[model samples]
Target: MSNTSRDAVLARIRQGLAAGPAPLPPRPDFAAPVHPPLNNPDIVVAFAESFQRVGGEFYYCESLEQLAVQLAAFQERQQVGPPYVWESDLQAVLQAAGIEFLADEADFIANADLSLTSCEALVARTGSVLVSAATESGRRLSIYPDQHLVLARPSQVVAEIGDALRVMQERYGAQQLPSMVSLTTGPSRTADIEKTLVLGAHGPRRIALFLLEEEENNG
Candidate 1:
């Protein structure tokens, strides 16, 4: 074998070793409202607004398509920017929403690219979005970029952390799970130095939640 062939084989072996722990089953999509109702919209609004209160900006949209629009616009406003990768599922929705997809990759790379994605339920109790590494859509789009935007319907929001975990176990079996599952609550925050809560400490400085309402339950 050539030197390049030996190098390729070695790289693949190292990659496998670093994959870490048993894999969780694929991220499962549960059939529940993406955004559950709160006794007061104030509670939900407050949860969303808390990000801004701490210096991070939050934008809530009615649908994924609206999110795509706002996401693209946000990139345009930034002095320094995160790469924009739109989820392909979102692309179809964007087109229908009247936003055109640019032909040039440069255009997207220039102003917010998008990655098509699907996510498990968002937990209502803590406003944390559950993501499993086992799913491609679940991984890169949320973490790689400097800013993260999650589009979930009210139907996918579950009530608590345990509920989200239960759903994961059901799909992947107990033995097979990702090395790490991230439960992100708002943006990264810390109050270490002077005990002043600071936002965007470890992750994106912005987060937007779109509570898409369904007709069946206005109750």
Candidate 2:
């Protein structure tokens, strides 16, 4: 086409576009649903039921000494020498009780029979334990071992995932957030092979939680 004809066509197209309907108004943001705060009993019950449904074992310990006794009994039944533990108060307790724990040896850790680690928070809504690379367990300790044991206090339990995340945020400020966060619900399982359910397909076959409850001081 000639230059004059092309310019006339472009002008007509622009004029037609300008005469079209105005753009639609922006949609209003939806209001979020409100939920009431959950009581401690409700949260604990929810966590227990959810965890059990997903093939997790739960134990209630009155104190660290009781936890140690239960752990010792478990170790004897499993016939394992010592578990791989992170640097924490639990380790000290075990040591004091003459229960050995392997140091941070990467090679040995992968082959260890069990791993004991501390979690940042427990989500009652999902029955999940929140962990992070910032903790002593890191990543491999929770995943590589054949069995996993978690030591959590009653105070660490939260009503939902949001509360658990908030705990992490407050513990480690925005600038010092951990490299990774893991929310583990239960023992690893898979139904990928011919729809046959198999446990420990990718991770530990067993997971046990020892919930330590301390007495409140009346004073």
Candidate 3:
């Protein structure tokens, strides 16, 4: 074959090799059950247990006030210095506990040692904090800080992943929704080296959850 033809043949072979196999579509997330776990004792226990299995601490309180108090105490014990953050009404909760609310600015997340966020829904089964982008304050405060404190009510606790999706749909219409919806299960953790669990490798090392009983009343 002439030099030009030989080059063309090699190019064709290269193209064939590069073609390879078609890309596979990503696996879809498994959907949770559609039914809510409201007033279900058995479901509640199971949900709480699952959270514990995932290295999360769960608590049931009489009221949101008590939960807030517990959170304050926990913060003190954990040595989480603040400049704490509350989305809106969370200010009242933290203020009552004497934790100052840091103002939101460019340096807000970088400067603050801890953050307190009140979320709309909690997936108890997964111990995930559901944060919609619609709540700008909550989203920023939760992810940016070194330690995240989430206040969730039992009423706000949904049974499974599907239930959370329903709540999100209700909060933000099907068409229009915030760009980010984070299902944060726990503090950022990794076991990169010799398989030893290392906390805070990616983000916050500590995540304290306050399962406020009366979410509406607290707000």
TM-score of each: 0.55, 0.75, 0.70
Descending-TM-score candidate ranking? 2, 3, 1
Error of 1 at 181 (Å): 1.3
Q: Is candidate 2 or candidate 3 better by lDDT?
A: 2
What C-alpha lDDT values do all the predictions have?
Answer: 0.59, 0.80, 0.70
User: Which portions of model 3 miss their true places by more than 4 Å?
Assistant: 1-42, 96-99, 104-110, 215-219
Clashes per candidate (backbone, < 3 Å) = 25, 0, 0
Highest TM-score model number: 2
Candidate 1, run of 10 with poorest lDDT: 210-219
Please, what are the lDDT tens digits per residue for candidate 3 over residues 63-169? Answer: 64676567667768878656455466777766665555674664774576777777767776676778766764645677767787776666777778778888888
Model 3: lDDT to the true structure: 0.70
Q: Candidate 2 residues 101-176, lDDT tens each?
A: 8867766744778888888988887789888898777887788888988877778888888889888889999788
Alpha carbon lDDT of residue 1, candidate 2? Answer: 100
TM-score of 2: 0.75
After superposition, the stretches of candidate 2 with alpha carbons farther than 4 Å from their true spots are 1-40, 96-98, 106-110, 215-219
